[model samples]
Target: MVTTRVTWDSLPDSIRRDIEARTGPLSSVEPVSSGFNSELAVVLRSADGATFVKGLRADHPRVWTQNREKAVNPHVRPVTAALRWSIDNDEWNLLAFEHTPGRHIDYSPGSLDLAKFVQSLRTLQELPCPDIELKLAEKRWASYTDSPELFAGDYVLHTEWSPSNVLVGDAALFVDWAWATRGAAWIDPACWVVWLIASGHSPQDAESWAAQIPSWNDAPADAVAAFAAAQAAMWSAIAEADPEPWIKDMAAAAQRWSESRRIGARSQTAR
Candidate 1:
């Protein structure tokens, strides 16, 4: 299991004293891992209850993802209300949020509750995206383009999509909103299929998952292969550059995604 380190800025004696004075007494100032930002402090004060304080570090590749998503996400209302709320408030250059309690989705590797996952994706797509001026998210897939072949068709892709990125709870709460971008929505679901395969799940076992979205079966096979290759190359670079210990499995998953698409293509041709 990967254990993430949580840390916070040193509270000044004045702030501590103010907190103590306002609240009856001080409790614990524990750090939470809701993000990979400057610092995330889950300050729990007996006097004022709880607040998630996020310290935003300027000029971070990671934080830029969150800002980009949050800006355009307002166009995708209720499906992304939590996001819209954050952007509209403009509350923090370095910010704090009220913590809402929720649980992550619990599905064994390869056995995704895909029905719900696809529904969630559709909901995100259905959201009305008004014209907004958010900077476009950086494309994660590049290695596949190294070959002489042309790149995949126009797609607003999220290079990162796995069970880890999605935190399903009372309302399919998607945490780690850093990788949000415009891309072929198919890439996300195909990425999931790649993840399932690497974890020792049979494609047939994931038939329920496969059945959940006809789009998977219907999308052009070449597109699927391109997406898988693009996604794989993207994360491999990320892992190599600044490895996030939690994502060691991603490299293998990317390979499987690319391979699966190839196998799928061969089968299509055979018929």
Candidate 2:
């Protein structure tokens, strides 16, 4: 599913010309790093200003992701880079965004960024999920869950929490909406806990950090348990499919968190 990363010049001249027609002549195109989805991630400089460009081929199988992102941006704008323009042509489907320069988030234990991240999640959880077609988290995680019913809710969730997906400026800016889903409000914080664990926080530490977020804190204990187990299964399957180190690490983290939750549940029952 991974495509070769492309630079500015890698784009077809016709495609570039089409893009330039809308944004004026591009003075320069500097490629950005840390993106896993888009083949093209660059900052295009023009007479007016710089714009962030993210795109893949128009015919790519994953082109639907671009449509999903473009649809979701207006809803999550304050917590994300503003979507400036969208181009759809035979050559490429590119989206230009207001370039927001900031450091990618650090999820390591005790990092000040953790509090800010929770705050951003709170703000995001408040935004209404724009009425659009989206994968339901319950259905998406169904194969991994004992009771999929527990996953239903009216909140739109951004399920990807890789450190690179969030940039910290005055506030944490979440990027990449391709995996966004509609489901339980607490699911996003639950997703963050796995990334925090993978980033070197202990399972208990990650849970404590997540508790700072209201949705996570207020989640029903049984529902949280279901979520943990579902994620453990989900990540384990992903790691098995492709034994990439980071994916494998996430699988292990999710397993550990799931085990910890199970043990806690048992102890509380026994008491």
Candidate 3:
């Protein structure tokens, strides 16, 4: 669900003062229009430099996402912008990160950004899952599949693959660790396949791209098929609840990939 966006000028005076104290009198504020998770997403510029800030009301239902991002940032180094500071008051909770300028990644077929994205994933896969409180993949997807245990693993997983979550400049950088999870390493690339399909790649082409990731190559065919089916169910529920066009597109992409996997499984069984 997209949080209602709040402008910089609309922030409570106390909150603005608290931020300015840390950032040293903001000279300019650029509201970030991408990503749905934060009520306040902006770039604050001062004589010192720029800082990226994202925050939520202290009492918001998803307030814990702020804590999750803070905890995970230190572990996920240069792959993500460094979290510089945080503020929590009776009214709000916010995190400040080193501002890095970049454009969102393009998942379209034949895009050069695809190779950069895969490289970024390879770098991320090398990092061990830090000992932090995070949602486990099996538990998160349990409602969508009977065999939730198949999704269990100790490896860190950034399960959301939306283009907005990745930025490419000198290098590809991943943001919004809000939905980060602990799961099988292969699951990250598997999740990306659906977004690839949504971006105009056929299921076969998407799988081919995912196969480039080392962990994906190690995933069992049956387990991947199961994951695809579970994802189809999961996205269907999400789209049904929101009825948003983008959500519906993702739901259709997931279903197509799931069906393709089922067909492949049947062909193998016949063989």
* Residue range 14-128, candidate 2, lDDT tens digits: 8888889878987888888787889889889999799998998998889899999999999998789899999987878899899888898989877899888988998998899
- Pitting candidate 1 against candidate 2, the one with the higher TM-score is 2
TM-score of each model, paired residue for residue = 0.70, 0.97, 0.99
Model 2 alpha-carbon drift over 4 Å, by segment: none
Model 3 C-alpha lDDT per residue in residues 1-118, reported as the tens digit of each score: 8899999999999999999989997789999999999999999999889999999999999999999999999999859999999998899999999998999998998999999988
Q: Give all candidates' CA lDDT scores.
A: 0.51, 0.89, 0.93
lDDT string for model 1 (175-212, tens) is 44445545444554565665665555665454346446
Q: Which candidate is the best by TM-score?
A: 3
> What residue runs in model 1 are displaced by over 4 Å at the alpha carbon?
1-6, 9-28, 34-38, 41-50, 59-62, 80-92, 109-114, 133-143, 146-159, 162-164, 198-200, 203-211, 214-218, 242-246
Screening candidate 2 with a backbone cut-off below 3 angstroms (N, C-alpha, C), the clashing residue pairs are: none
The better candidate by TM-score, 2 or 3, is: 3
lDDT of 3 at 247: 98
User: What's the C-alpha lDDT at position 260 in model 1?
Assistant: 68
Best candidate (score: lDDT): 3
